[model samples]
Target: MTETSKNLIAEYYALHLGELRAFVAKCTGSPADSEDMVQTIFLRLLQTDKMISAVTLPCLVYSAARNIVADYWRHRKSVERHETYVKSHCDCGTDSGPASVYAPAEIMQLLERGMARLSPKSRRIYTMSVVGGMRVSEISDTLGVAYKSVENRLGAARKEMRRYMSRMLA
Candidate 1:
């Protein structure tokens, strides 16, 4: 920046540092957060070529600090909310958790082989119920079959696949 701009900013810093410190400290409630925020308010002036009016420097600097404080609280609140959700709702157990219950590629390979062994009609019904996310009643209506036939096929398909996955996985 030009020397003129740098000197102008330095003068503003000299005049406003204490007020900015107090304002930010009051806004955030933490001395450490205020220190960073006070520095940020001054540094933001470095990006601008225009000078703050001597008549309005307090309004200008305080407004910038207010915006920074708002953003800090907003980000902190989001992080706190995410941490709370994870603490209450997630079970991400240690290494032995459901997170590692399956090796994904291995499981997929076993599933593909088991599916290959199913009779085509059973496979179609199972695919509709599982992969296509269709209910048994929906599958029955779409395929013009009785709902009981759809349920039996779905049950048998699930039983066979479970047995196949267990035998292969074990």
Candidate 2:
């Protein structure tokens, strides 16, 4: 685009920034998402090679903001649906709600079996975090392991335990 077109866009963006932000917020009903959408709108404008006419810039900005809000809601719904599907199919007893299905006796028996199956390092890391109430950083410092290693082992341990519990319960 020409310098003149750039100047026009800059001026228009500067003059109407708040209106654009408010427009997105009203469209999405979320100030946080609106802020992101506003940035995306201007970033698209600034990066594009096509020259936008001064008269048409406002319409294009509003139209793009509307499209972004629609896309955000669509993506949000898709994610929620995916989560719902996973929750319905899997009874891993990872959280308190579904985990209540197992009686205390069954939970104890399953937990012991699960812990026994994990690698020694993973089992120790899991214990340090869960039983010892230690954070990942503290565990890493005490064990002289990388922070990520401690974190990863904790995740692996949990996954292993969950799989074992699920299999036993099934």
Candidate 3:
């Protein structure tokens, strides 16, 4: 903020830019990413008053750079892992797929039959829980039923649906 602080930070940047860039590049394995990270670290230094007042400027800079690169890698790895999971789980219509056994129309008909077989109360509870995305507690409150009663009804509904679906599929 002050002239002295600005000058000191400017001098530190001039002296350490190359070393910082090299260290970040080695860690990140990408020149462009390393350059960007180095700039981010210096920007952080400018924003953080404690960093500007630190006794060892180079040490602080290198430490901040390392931390930033480490965070970048951590974030990148997390994103890569999530992408892998999404790619594997997404329904892209491969031959070996969850829908391979039953056509969508057949499954829908079976589901309708199964739902029809449930008692009216059970069907309402099941629809509220599954189709309506209502939690058991919310359903209980809305229906003025006990929580355990709602759970029991939902369970019975699921069992009936499972039995009906099994018979239809077979």
Q: What Cα-based lDDT does every candidate model obtain? A: 0.80, 0.83, 0.81
Per lDDT, the best of the predicted structures is 2
Q: TM-score winner between 2 and 3, please give it.
A: 2
Off by over 4 Å in 1: 91-170
The TM-score obtained by model 3 is 0.51
TM-score of each: 0.50, 0.53, 0.51
Looking at model 3, report the run of 10 residues with the lowest lDDT sum: 85-94
Q: Candidate 3 on 23-139: residue-level lDDT in tens?
A: 899989999998888888888777666735547667788889878888788878977996686456545556767665567787788788889888889999999987896779889
lDDT of 1 at 61: 77
Question: Which lDDT tens digits does candidate 1 get at residues 25-100?
Answer: 9888988889887887778777656666656656777778888888789878977996686455434465556664
Off by over 4 Å in 2: 92-170
State model 1's lDDT.
0.80
Selected candidate, larger lDDT, 2 vs 3: 2
Worst 10 residues of 2 by lDDT: 92-101
**Cα lDDT tens digits for candidate 2, 22-124:** 9888877899888878988888787778768988888888888888898788878977996686557666556557454667787688787789888889989
